[model samples]
Target chain A: MALLEVMNVGIAFGGLQAVSQLDIKLEKGHLYGLIGPNGAGKTTVFNLLTGVYRPTEGDIILDEKNITGKSPAKINQAGIARTFQNIRLFGEMSVLDNVKIGLHNQIKYSAFTGIFRLPGFKEKEQEMDYKALKLLKIFDLDTVAQSPASSLPYGKQRKLEIARALATNPKLLLLDEPAAGMNPSESEELMNTIKFVQKEFDVAILLIEHDMNFVMGICEHIYVLEYGRIIAQGNGESIRNNPRVIAAYLGGD
Target chain B: MNAIKNLKPSTCNNLINYGMVLVFYIVVQILVNAGVLNNSMQGMLVPICTYVVLAVSLNLTVGILGELSLGHAGFMSVGAFSGAIFWMISGSQMSPVVGFTLAIMIGGIFAGIFGALIGIPVLRLRGDYLAIVTLAFGEIIKNLLNAIYVGWDSNGFHFSMKDVSALGLDESGEVIVNGAIGITGMPKASTFTAGTILVIITLFVILNLITSRAGRAIMSIRDNRIAAEATGINITKYKLMAFIISASFAGMAGVLYALNFSTLAAKKFDYNTSILVLVFVVLGGIGNIRGSIIAATVLYVLPELLRELQDYRMLIYAVVLIAMMIFNQSPQVLAWRSNFVSKISRSGIAARFIKQKRQSEEV
Candidate 1:
């Protein structure tokens, strides 16, 4: 069974279909990519899958469980984590705290246990500290562990966003424009990080990127969207040769 | 070992904060013990501690939860009246200490329930909307309490609306809450020691909550609501947790306030009262718990210190507040603080203390 399946999911706003008939399926540990030009609703599709906007039409199944219309937090608890097109690190917090919060669902202790510093709370803290640092280490952010998140450079902030999401221990990870603001070399580094995350954490990955080379390079299968619809779906080799994909990208301009 | 090294910075900050609270509490106690603080000055103790609790709790909601709440006074009034009523009925039967303690607890629980009720819908409204809703709630509760009449007679407990005549009691009715008169004949069970203990408990619980998983979830919501949700934090759960917990502490403070006085008035908790607490939080440096304690104590004590200069006291307070706001936000002050901490840490005294602490704990 697929790890996640969005069957005919669609959302509309003021009579405009922002995302429609978005059928997506991800097997365990697979790397899938969603690419579309400006105004093609790639981020909207990510929002739909991650529960930012509930689809007006069909179902979202995670691990064969129907998760349609669940709250964003519930979707995350069901093993789907996502980053944003805009980096959303907890600005005033330490880098480590940014990731520990991502582990909110996993920590097993009550407010009473925390206030009293019960044995379970401390054990959970040590466990969470271990897990958070491990993810930070992978993203090369362990050096600035105590620094405020807002102090990080743009590339580091983007990487930290992904690291924080990884701390959530998701079965599937969604990256919305993770490579948006990076320089060529930075995007290259992000690609390596994405590949490392896919293999190291063994989580299926889905990313929305405008960078053609970056998406095509790392993605096993790519879906091209146009005007809230998936225009084509194939491996990079097939997509590069598809006429419809070319027409959508060009808009026949 | 590497993990321990990584943990050093945040742990040191906590140590400094804990040390500050202990030192402040002890210094005042010593001054009182030495008779350096006069009767009037000593009287400021309970109020100072009460305000400290109030400021810290409000900071949790306004700073940590990143929402403006103007109905804190409403929650406090709920706690104050509820706890006052409990003590008045029970104080005669039990030890004063037990009665007072129970009063605060019951008040906290009641306030927490109100917090949940108001927070469930109010917190869903972002920013200014939350503030306006809470403001309305504060006024509504105050008016409701003013119009409430609780009395007792040989027949049993009697409650009436608007006036005592509605109760149809004979001349034997013991009026507890009269219209606009509020609760009268409140026993002076709120003492300085009790206030101090509550302050410590408030700090311990609130500061610990900040470091816990739940606290981080609340702060994350404050920092980035969307990212907090994306990371699987149930925003509503954490928001209400912070709001209710904060309200409960404020309620405990209200119980202390009622105990410190002879009578209680619903009007004591009004728009101005909420604003005063908010000023303490802002002056204390929003999210800083230690800062709240210091700010509340210093600000509360300032007017007392200038009591001799009664005419000019208000002017001095206004000036000090303006100066504090400027100094608190100054880049130079922030830089100096970082510099001072780093210098002290490099001396290894902090590290040595940590080592000794670790050894003692292991033992």
Candidate 2:
């Protein structure tokens, strides 16, 4: 069975259909890309899948469990995690703590145990710390684990956010414009990291990116969206050369 | 088990705080027993402890949860009146021990229930709107108390809103509470020791919650609500949890206030009192439990100590507040505090506490 399936998803706000009849599917460990011009409703589809918005009509099934319209937190605990188009780390907290929060669903210590300084509180906390450190290490962020998240450089902030998302132990990961402001070299580095994460974590990826090179370089399958509809979708080579995709990006007078 | 062996700063921090409270309690009690403290100084002890509980709990709402609550005093009044009624009803047959203990329990529970009730609706609104709604609730509660009347005797229990005459109690009936006048001639059952114990419990609960997974979720919400929600943390549940816990502690403070004094009036807990508690949380450095405790105790005592300087008292108080604001927000001071904290965690009591715990586990 496929790991995730989105069937006939549709949504509208004030008579304007933001997305309609969107269908997608993913097998385990697959790398997929969603690309579009500005305001192409790519993010709207992501918001619907992550439960930030309820589809006006559709079903979102993960591992055969219909997860449409659930709370964002519930959708996350169901083994999907995402990074924002704009990085949203908890600025005042340490880098380690930002990652640790992603592992919130995995901790088991009760209020009683926490209050009484019971053995379980200690063990669970220490284990989480170790796990958080390991995640930081993967992104070369272990050295600055004690620094506040906002203190990190912009590129590092993006990497830290991705690391934090991975700490959620997701079966499916979503990246929203992961290479938004990076130069060519930095975008190249991010592409490598994306591929590494898909391979090492064995997690299916659905990333929204405007950067064609970044998306085409790493994605096995690509879906193109424009004006709340899927204009075209195919393997990277086919979507890149598709006339409709080119026309949407390079608009006519 | 291994987490305990690591002896995280929170565990050691609680221990250090407990010691401070315990030592302070003993020293003050000893001073009173030895007559080293004058009558006025003695009178201030219970209030100090009560305000400590109030400030620390308020910190949970204002500091940690990052929500403003202007009806904390309303919850306190709920606890104060309920607790006072219990103490009065049981005064005849029961010992003061049972009366006061039951009073605290009933008071805390009622305050907590009201906290949840009010929070469910009010929490839906954020920032200034919440503050306005809670402020309105506080005023409403104060006015409600002014209209309530309660009495009891062999005939039955009586309660009325309009007037005492409407209660229709016979000559044998005893009036426990009368409209506006409130409870008077109540037994002074709130002791310094009881207040001290309450403070300890408040610290334990607050400290424990802050270190636990639940606390992390709450703080995460405060730091970034949308991000926290995206991380799968239930925003409403944790926000309500913090609010209710904070309210109940304020309720416990109200119980202490009622028992420590001879008369109980809802008017004592109004907008001013709520603001006073907020100031304690703020001056102490929001979300810092130890800072809140010290700030509350010292700030409460300042007015009494300035009694001799009556004419210039308010002036000095203003000056002190301004100084505190500067000291609290100064960049140099904040940098110094963070450095001090890291040092303390590395080689201070935290290190020693961890070592001791490990040694005990091995033995």
What's the count of clashing pairs in each model shown?
0, 4
Write out the backbone clash pairs for model 2.
Answer: A73-B232, A122-B3, A122-B4, A123-B3
lDDT of 1 by residue, B28-111 (tens): 889988989889988888888889999999999999999998888888999998898888776536888888889999999999
Kindly report the root-mean-square deviation of model 1 from the true structure over all alpha carbons: 2.0
All candidates' lDDT scores?
0.88, 0.87
Could you estimate the TM-score for every candidate? Answer: 0.95, 0.93
For model 1, name the residue pairs that clash: none
Candidate 2 Cα RMSD after full superposition onto the native fold (Å): 2.7
Writing each residue's lDDT as its tens digit, candidate 2 over B1-363 gives 332234355467778889999999999978988989998899889999889999999999988899888888898999999888888878425776777888998899999999999899989989899989999998898889878999988888899998888898998898888988999989899989999999999998998898778887888888888788888888998999999999998888899989999899778888999999889889988877887898888789988888799999989988888777666767799899779978986887767777887678679
Judged by DockQ cut-offs, is candidate 1 incorrect, acceptable, medium or high? medium
Native interface contact recovery, model 1: 0.82
True contacts kept of each: 0.82, 0.65
The top-ranked prediction according to lDDT is 1
